[model samples]
Target: MIYSPPRQANFFMIFSHGNGCDIGTMDTFMKILSDELNTHILIFEYPSYGLCQGSVDINKTTVNNHAERAYSFVHETLHWPTDKILMYGHSIGTGPACHIASTKPIGGLILQSPYTSIQNVITGLIGFPGYLFGNSYWNNLETMKYINCPTLFIHGERDGLIPSEHSKTLYNSLGHIENKQIILLPDDDHNSISYTMSSSCVKSFLKQFFPPSNQLLPEINIDPEFRVPPETIQTSSSIFSYNPFTSLFNLSTVSINATQSVYNSMFSNQYNNQ
Candidate 1:
């Protein structure tokens, strides 16, 4: 569902979804944003969600895989710097978005209706430790600690799945990469946060976070006519195939199943080569 415009621009809007959600659920927001920003938006899927399958014990949708894959695609294939991208997360999307901002050189990041951790929320709800629960997804708190980009945190005050306090916890953790802002709506719930997403203030948000420069195009001032959703996007082809940034670091050829030992070595090599 991520629409790629023909010519590559410096700025890319990357959307990461929650556990069971697919890029389809996020298309409306991205299209609206594209029309406003006059550019393309790439929304990614979590494993076992939407078109993505072949389950990994750890959710492919987790911060570890999703963040690094997209980051590699942009830096290696597109041959762009982190300064040319914006990381956007919603609900569970908050995990990868925050992780990318911490590891990638991004212009900014956005988190909507985010949670501190699923484990934390479950413990609060069930009066038991989250780690004691069979599936513990309450680890995003640790990732939020490293975010270094300008960030926008938007949470519905009346959310059911997660509370605005989660966003507050994250805002307090960031040390002002450029600017960090949080918006709370009076009667909004987790899903209803999308309604406020279409608000006119998005123009200002884009202006501030993903600024318009001769460097990157601004969102088109007009809204887009809702288009029929496509069945799939071809992701195998490289979009940034010609860039030399990737050549210098040699990071893309690594395997999908490598252990942390193999993966950490690449970063170490990159550090030594630099």
Candidate 2:
């Protein structure tokens, strides 16, 4: 495990890396997240990946066991609050992250290049039926229904290996979450998202829970190419909607005053692509 400490961290982020990436390759990305959010981070190597012992275990059961162990190391052993810990998963790491979130209480979740399920990704990639892999990561779609925390979805539009559609599907499934955001980078591919994209939008999502002090950073202008999708904000009578064709982040004219029936219809129509 690698720990990067900040003077006054809002929370400790438990980060999971994608396939073929261990803690070493993720060092630079860890530094970037830490610097952007002013938070401590813990990144660990998977079994048999990098310098770890034994064989690689990508099965959902084994992966969930590993995630529980890490959670215990920090929350049980070190005595961190369950509500203050955030789980972040990239690519295959989303499997374990979603598993832990379904079983544990967490402040938030961040899924980068997430998929509805590995089987769905496989089906999309090779045109094979998902049922052929019956015992596979069966139901992230089902697990997501139980996770109601604030969430963020990040993906690259040009990701050839796992298309951005995966993230869109995952985002649409987050019906229980009151606050959520999605960012689609136009120019970035699977591997380049970490370095090519700006962390400003990520920090924006984190700040609602961890408010900054007097020392505020100046707002950085985001490049027009990186498209940040509409975020959902809860209100007394209705939910705020995202307008894709707008200049500002939150446009009032597109505000959706949804009754229960209208909300369902609006949400279904807005995310119909999934």
Candidate 3:
């Protein structure tokens, strides 16, 4: 799925979503992100997630392949220059985002609720080394050595699912990169960071690197039907409500029932133990 602003965008972001939500659930958040940053965003749907049809595979290789295809679509089909593309990933998506940023030439990178490696996450959770059972999947700490672009890592200091130390470790790993930053939200958790502080952080980060073009463009008048009702927009203290905007876009036709179950299994240690 793609979201473009009314004016020509200076940079484009290839977004990889986290577990438990598909493109359908992410529609409102992405729209708000596109509007706030005034940049085009292309969300890559993993296999068997959203409307994409294929066997589900969440390993680093499969997810990285999907991310590469999304990158090619933007570079080849959309004609966006490689230097103007930004990679944004959340949660499990950070694996592919790091892979792409390390191997490809991108403007910048944004990682939310990231982990050093899948093994590290399990080790932290179960008090056992994750590598003892199998190979390390999505070893971002190793991948960070190759990333030279400006990067931002966001995490909730109160995150219970993936501790804040994961982002801290990743931030410390990028010592060679001058334009790197990490933001820890005091009031946020693993899932609340997106709805609470992400927009402001993203906007500030873009201004530092990819400022908009000097030429002025006419203001865009959002159609009434597409404009989210003011009452529906929640304050920082309230939970975000997606019910109002759920029917506005047809791009999320795929059912999320199966996707949710798959995500739960992937994250559960019980499945890993088997």
Best by lDDT: 3
TM-scores for all predictions? 0.70, 0.73, 0.76
Every candidate's lDDT: 0.60, 0.66, 0.74
Error of 1 at 177 (Å): 4.0
The pairs that clash in candidate 3 are: none
Global fold similarity of model 1 (TM-score): 0.70
Task: Write down the worst ten-residue block by lDDT for model 3.
Answer: 233-242
For model 2, what is the C-alpha lDDT against the true structure? 0.66
Question: Model 2 over residues 114-138: C-alpha lDDT tens digits?
Answer: 8777657555554445466564463
Residue 41 local lDDT, model 1: 63
lDDT of 3 by residue, 1-274 (tens): 6777776666789999876677667778888888888777888777655555445544557668999999988777667777778999998889899999999899899999999887786555544446764663688899999999999999999987789999999999999998988889998888877653687898888788665666433333334543332222211110011222121112122323343455466669676898
Can you tell me which runs of candidate 3 are displaced by over 4 Å?
A: 211-274
- Give the Cα error of residue 90 in candidate 1, in Å: 0.8
The C-alpha stretches of model 2 lying farther than 4 A from their native spots are 55-58, 196-198, 209-274
